[model samples]
Target: MNKKNLRNFLFTNTFFIVLFLGILMVISLFISSNILFKNIYDSTIQNSVHSISELYNENMKYFEYFSSKYQDIVSEILDELYKNYINNIPFSSNLTIENFRKIGIFKNVDYYIINKNGIIIETSYDKDLGLNLANRVPNYWKKLNEELNKNNKYIEGISYEIKTNNPRIYGYLRMEDGNIFEIGILIDERAIPNFPKTVSSLNLNFIKSIYTYNISFIPYSFEFPLLDEEDKNIFNSLEISKGEIKTYTLRENSNGKESYVYIKWVPDKVNNKEFNFTVLTKISIDLSSIVILKNSIIFIFIVLIFFVIFSLALYLNYMTNRIEKPIMKLINNIESGKVDADAETNILEIDTLIKYYSHLVNTLVEKLKEEERDYLELKEKLQMIEKEKDLLYEMALKDDLTKLFNKKGSVQIIQKLVLNKESFSVIYLDIDNYNNILEKLGQNEANDAILSLVEIMKTIFRDRDFIFRVDENEFLILLRFVNLSIAQKILKRFVDALKKFNITSDKPYKISVSYGIIEYKGQNIEDLYNEARNKMEMMKMKKLELLKKLSDVNAEEN
Candidate 1:
């Protein structure tokens, strides 16, 4: 409330209010503009996908038409070759190479005719004429017969020449009387230029057989010049099946350009024989439209925000000066060692804030004093509740008489060990004659004897070992990091100690424990416990047999 201090506070507070308003306005405009830009981008991608789908459908129609026409022409040529056959002449010799050459079917194909004897009786290649094809290719006729038997007259597959290992597409016909007329065409990618139909970014491939239907094994494939190395890579990776259309993005390439690719697979059957073809298309994308629109909208929005903020700031500065003048006078009076009556303002909110701030100061002082007294009282109550909770938990988990973990607690610990895959052994111990002791010394004395046995086990076993009173007369011990021999050694020491340990009861009693221990590998706790119990029953049987023998010897001596 000094003159210099008041002036600095007034200027700093006014500057911060202006800065905060400006930031809020800018953020509001930015968020709205970003949401609008995202909507425009999503709409663009959806439109592009629609357009590309229409283009793909149109191109596939042309490919299907041309393939069907090619198959029809081949069938006609085969009929013409058979028309010259006579009943008296051998079937293969009736259709000579000259007849096939004249029919225009062999213009781009090497023609041959093979008889049932598996000999090429007529061939366009003079060297192959009269060659025993069955001897040369034992499985060739077998495969042809298999296809023909399935009612497929026209079959196409990859075949190689007997003399030269050159590959060719062997499209053949299976005539009656077991005579085969075959046409082998060397694949030329440019031979069927119209199959691709000169569409930009469109590539076509004609696969001869069903087995070579994918890009990796295509017999004939052609790529348009518009498809770059990146597009080719995307095409190669495609795994389209028959009648499938797929779309995916191609990432940064050698030139760091990205694009989208679409592929389709078409399959057709001609005269009961199947053929497959695949089409791949790619298109480049540009973000110029979205970027330009976003930038222009953001610029105009920001200008509008600036105008609104500027008008608001001017009006607020005028009001701030008017309101703070009275506040400054009130502070000065207080600093000059005078008690203020009140601060008044015409604005209702500002008047209310001043009134409430004074009331809040007095209320907070009283509340602090009240809270201190309540906190001390709550602290004592919380300590007592925590102690009670601890006692309840211990009672739930521990046996009342022996203070060993009960069945529920022991099972929980075993489940944790199994989950952790820790190596341990379970030793099941049973009291040999607990019922006899109970009959002789009553319930309380028998209970004391059992407690003494638990104490003896505590002294004999390590602290880490978990001891449990899991049954009425059974005590289970889980020994960690101990093998069968180590567990046996510990149990032996427990029995020896129990023989001499005194049970604090009205009558003296000697305790004996029969134990069965099994080292755990990976079995469930139930299975391991059952196995240990079985071993303890066996030990009990052996001890009974020894006692019977001793009794008989004493009888004979008497």
Candidate 2:
């Protein structure tokens, strides 16, 4: 064909090729972008969850610690009430309240005492006195009473709605002398209020403020007005379980435009039953700006790749046209059994092709007298040389023993696959006790065994799959677009094949192989390889243990 025909053929066949490549490029870009975005999202969520959990935990610890110290103070107060009032003759109720008030003077907490019948006999806060505590006793107290009845000490995290606009945590102690006394400590919510704000401030200079709520589901303190109508609805709708983290969104106004609000729930302790406490923090990401930036990047890359490919195609078409035209004219003349006396071309390739055609036509005339033997021999020799060149190229990139691709070839193929961003699986295989086998059987038998193994591998693996010898005793197999189950099936087949082979020399032995297979989904290649290698090592160790047991059994029998 002439150069024009050649160009036309390529353009026709590769029309789908270019279109397919373009679609692939777009898909690859989208997948890469999605992976990067997911990584960012996961990392953000992880860090936020960790920080909020830590803050809630520390806050709970502080509250528990403070409540314990307050318990000691309550013990002293109860002892005084028993010694100075209850045990003394003609017990004065007024003296108890007055002494309790005196005891509260040095303490930083609000305190209250209830009688055996659940009456608020005395309280440090004046507004609480004479209130019937029977109706207000927290559920935790009832549970605690059950425990105490069974002769167990009662220690619990309890929550109750106090008279103030806030809730309070109380530590209660039932005295041995039949009077029940409770010590109420208004948990200082503000002690760790700034924690979420501190974390929100990190890498988020864009966030204006942060808010934190207690386990009571009350917005105790916040750096900003945390609950808008929608946010409140979301919070109310949350069905949080213990130690579970949930995320929600909110909307806010910033710079006279609407912004996003993010809230996350984190538990203080896994076993905590009373309160599903969470630390809620919010930030506004400029979604419109991010969309615009992402679109701009995609547009730029598409334009760049399109222009480069288009230019290269044009250049190749031009060179092909220069070579094809003269060659086609010479071929037509030879087919008519006449020389093209007027044929001439400025291009060197075109001129050479024409001269070759003329010589071939002259040879054909002579071959008619010699039965075309010389021409057939010359063609056969040319084919052999081409085959040898191809063999050399393959040999340069392959392992001699396994006849599989070497390290360099494996890396090259993997890099190309990565660029395509297609899903694939990698299986790393190590022959268990390969060195010991070599030592027992010697090098000659070991080589025969390896060659036989290569034959088995070629039969098991598909033409599309890439098998490589990565180390002395390890083979790495790359399976494209395959899932874990398919990779495992192939590995099982390989193991089965090895089991069928029995190579014997000085010592008869069965081949043993251990493999680790990993199905990747846009994970880092090196990390995936390391994970697979670790699994392979674990498998190898198990096999070695089994082998050792077998050996011990044989020795005992002998």
Candidate 3:
């Protein structure tokens, strides 16, 4: 080879080898340091999270105990209050509720008179007005009904008001007419000093440990005080986008202080199983010493590697020991300050696979959510169509004037009953003096009388029984699972209610009703209905004849 060409080739090869070797060493060291830091950081966070969870569990015990005690005292007080009032007042058709209403207005006292159907027939508070508890809270309502059958003294723990969500103490008692009397009072009215008021945040100082910790109670809806209004709003929106998260701890850095931020839930097991509250605990642990030790070890290794690079031909073994010795010592924790581990080549590979898999899983989750949204939208549309169909069906069945079932609805009900072959009785009533009343009081007053009669029938009959206005001043009632005797008893009750209405009313004339009942015993519905109507006609004739006799006797006496 020529001298000039040989010299140029050697120089080019040596330059490349040195440059590439230096780059490889720097990269290897950098990767190793990062791996070491991650392991130590992960370990420290895991230990802090465990400690925070333990402390939070210990803290909830005190709150639970106080909650039980508070409920006990309130239950006893409300129990006695209900006992005294229910016994003294009693239930009556003519009972004046004005005094009770006045008391309800002044005090935060709520009272409900519920019928056998679990409907609130009358209530002091608007929240309970017309409420059907049987459909809403069946278990609790069933328990109340059971108690009514037994001792009629049922008291329960604290619960939120249905509409207000304000805590209330409640009790129930049995009343006449198969009705239930329920009473509720605001909890604040009964609360005394030293009552456990829900707090937002607390700064507790541990005198023995010389540690000051900040524990904050998080409401379902909350705002952090440290953030400005605009930033707070942005963060809250982001939090919502992240969805609801609970019962976890993670490392957080704020205002130069490092801490384990814990989110926990404390349930009110003693009072209500469905009730629970959230707490956020931040425990700061000093990590400065660990950081310092880790940095110092890293610095020593970095210096040793450079020394190895400069003296590789002569003192390679010596430089390698220098680098290895310090790392080996650091592998053992420094006064429990620093955590270390042997670097793994697979750490980076595993992390990359995890990120790629997470992206795929997230994409799948979004697709599933979109499918769920479509399902819900379709379900809502179907429900709306179903509701519209129901409304149209109801309009067809209901009477225009009195809001009772008409002829068409009555025919449907009878045909169904006959098809099923269930025992039932038909009762027909005709207003004997409907024409006379129309002539005397005009059409409006006559309509008022008919409405009054309908109300009386409704008050007397069970809700399960059906009442139909067949024609003007002519009404029909169909009672299922009832014999002719039961139908007669119901008619008697209607007479009693009508009598009360006439006595209390300020109308110009008294109201009267005539009824005829026939039990269906495998007979034609037309024949039975005709028989009931004929019987009513006969009763009307007999009354007219008696009136004529009375008139003649009065004429003779005069």
Indicate which candidate wins on TM-score.
Answer: 2
In candidate 2, stretches whose alpha carbon ends up further than 4 angstroms from where it belongs are 1-4, 58-70, 78-107, 113-169, 173-181, 186-210, 215-217, 229-233, 236-292, 328-558
Per-candidate Cα lDDT values, in order, are 0.63, 0.62, 0.61
Tell me the deviation in Å of residue 93 in model 1. 99
- What's the C-alpha lDDT at position 492 in model 2? 85
Across 46-85, the per-residue lDDT of candidate 2 in tens digits comes to 5555555565555555445544544555556445544443
> In angstroms, what RMSD does candidate 2 have relative to the true structure?
17.4
Q: What's the lDDT of the predicted structure labeled candidate 1? A: 0.63
Query: How much does each candidate deviate from the true structure in C-alpha RMSD?
Result: 24.4, 17.4, 28.4
**Candidate 3 lDDT, 108-171, residue by residue in tens:** 5566778888898887676678888888657557867776688866655444455444445566
Q: Where's the lowest-lDDT run of ten residues in candidate 3?
A: 206-215
- lDDT for 416 in candidate 1 is 92
How should the candidates be ordered by lDDT, best one leading?
1, 2, 3
| Regions of model 3 farther than 4 Å from truth | 1-356, 545-558
